[model samples]
Target: MRYGLTFLALSAALAALAVLAGGAALVLLWPAMSFGLVGAAYLARRPALLGKRPDGTQAAWALVLLGPYFLLTWATWRAERALGRADCANEVVPGLWVGRRPLGDELPAGVRLVVDMTAEFPAAAAVRRHPGYLCVPTLDGTGPEVERLRELIERLRGVDGVYLHCASGRGRSATLAIALLLERGLAADVDEVEAQLRQRRPGIQLNAAQRELLRRARARPGA
Candidate 1:
């Protein structure tokens, strides 16, 4: 009877964690992963739910279930660290005026082309007027907009370098750089990318229009 009750409690806890994790994904990413872990812990605790194990078999089953979680977490942490390190390296470029680490900066001279992410401001206007292309808002890591960005990058004619600028250079701006280099397999140094932004423009301050654009951009999944 005691064992049966423990199983029931574990089941309830797992259900609660699922709901909580789903809710958290709306606001943050990492916390949702934590909630996912509760379900795994429940499984590790209740081996019989899957199949009856012989005595002393629980240890093997526990390892099987928990091993993936540890590996995934380790891999994710390593990736984040690598990205952070890349941003740090970019910070040393003297001419680029960074609003924050790995974000917003001045356009370098040979960067005759610009790809502008849609957001309010003089910066957006500057990029639009500059001699390149315009790629509008896309959600985090998915959808038709992402495809459009790919097309734009591919279609670009001769240009020394492309400078992508957005207001405040946070979500959509930084996300685009990450996707191009990391997800889409484009090769561009982050520091060199920062140099292409126009330092003379009034800092990385975003007006009301840019803020609204970002809110909409973030509303997309996985952002």
Candidate 2:
């Protein structure tokens, strides 16, 4: 409540200043500033609202600052579509997709299974509505959980159109995706998997620990 009031006060002050200054650029800039202030205040008060992904918030605020409120809505929809592509969540292969925490309704039609790799439950209530949702809680490391994940992936191979996700869809999600690729013999080795993932989803990165986990998973007896 306090933050909301502060944002209103700041926005009014800036808008008033813009009116008094009578400068065209300041008039244009004040709206963006006001939008940014609102985003900052809301995020400060509830950092977990967007979970681990700030890009969505950032993009929304940017659009709000640049145009009318209605236009902001349109931009948000477009941004979401772009996000799936930018994060390489749309489709890594013919029937496989990877992404961050996604709500059940946001999933593409005909997704037979969802493999959630987030360490904790997602904030979205709709995620629980998915019939094939499976949560595999795991931290960002090379632990026993990796083996468990491999086993689960192996068991789910027959299922088509699987969607795998983590909190940010960058590290853990990519790790599991690569692991699955190797396990299924889709790619020849770790380097091949990495090359393919990067080719499909540019800027996909993995940490040392995750890379090491993949290496160990690859070296296992029947891996």
Candidate 3:
């Protein structure tokens, strides 16, 4: 599931279990596996799968996740909308969009680029087919890497449409979208743009780290 505090807490507790059990962590393997699969869905990697496919970890792991993991994502997104949280996706600007991860191949009509911020999922088949995909593998509840984001922003300088996505479209995706706006000089004030974004998509939110990164983008250009 979501990383930040939850991932860290669970990991800490699991470490305690191992220590008290004299390293018999396997005693908790079943529950550990469950938690790990959920974490993978949110932030882990099958990097080779993103390769043209390092992530060649041979096991039923990929099978389980790509199959059931996706179903779980579907249910989660549905529930997110039902609870007045984040929806599947939203177009914030005419040519720029932000939202949760796309579970399928076909993107919104003209979205030629898929900027996946999470670590695990591969670009959809269609995205790979057309070679219009980029994965910048950031963990949930964190900010993305700096240099890659700059390069991608430059690449998107005049593109007709782009879709920026993270796990829930709430934090990471919105943060990046705000940076893009600031970089392109479309919006000068961070708070104002964020307000506009929230109006368009009520569930849009940026975590503290995400907001700090955005602030850095303004305080230091091309950073």
Candidate 4:
């Protein structure tokens, strides 16, 4: 029964693809595809409900589909690990680290200040236990708030070691790291700051608005 359900689901998916290719509207095939998916999920959860067993050929087709399913799952797992490596934290400068939220309680010694740029506080109870955890909620955009962010960073920089992060450590955190580098005169320009960051954190990303904000902030008098 499970094998039969798998075949039906696969067939429905193929039919949906064919309909899409034929220039038919998706609404025409969505019901069939959805019904097949629901049926398969139901059978998977309660295999005994079907009572009857599948023949050998039906079982074989099911195994064939199952093989790709398992392979795809493994590929997804590996890809996630690779992507995690790309986003792992790295020291942007001496005593300064940036990346996605760090795991475990074993942060490096001297990391006394943790600046969280995420819109919401981190869910980890362990993270909240840090001695100096500061949350500065912001998004990736240009606004008067950039000046306040600079001020926040300035206060945090007085500590010996600072760790900066956001939800993904890609947009808002990277933007602030660049801003910090500019404020400190450690980087001559946005391009230079970005180059340094990318060298240390391979997947660091900054949106157009963040880049423009950095430029405008850097150009302001006494910035």
How well is each residue in 137-157 modelled by candidate 2, as lDDT tens digits? 554332224566668767777
Best by TM-score: 3
Model 1, residue 59: C-alpha shift (Å):
65
Model 1: ten consecutive residues of lowest lDDT: 95-104
Q: Which portions of model 3 miss their true places by more than 4 Å?
A: 1-5, 12-27, 33-87, 221-223
* Per-model CA lDDT versus the true structure: 0.37, 0.61, 0.64, 0.59
What TM-score against the true fold does each predicted structure earn? 0.31, 0.57, 0.69, 0.57
lDDT of 1 by residue, 109-195 (tens): 545545544211213234344554444432211122434545554554232355544333444454444334322223354333323
Q: Cα RMSD (Å) between model 3 and the true structure?
A: 5.6
Candidate 2 has its poorest 10 consecutive residues by lDDT at: 49-58
- For model 3, give the 10-residue run with minimal summed lDDT: 49-58
The TM-score between candidate 4 and the true structure equals: 0.57
The top-ranked prediction according to lDDT is 3
lDDT of 3 at 177: 87
Q: Which regions in candidate 1 have their CA more than 4 angstroms from the true location?
A: 1-106, 122-127, 133-144, 156-160, 183-223
Better of 1 and 2 by TM-score: 2
Model 3 C-alpha lDDT per residue in residues 24-71, reported as the tens digit of each score:
564554444444545544454222332213121223555453444345
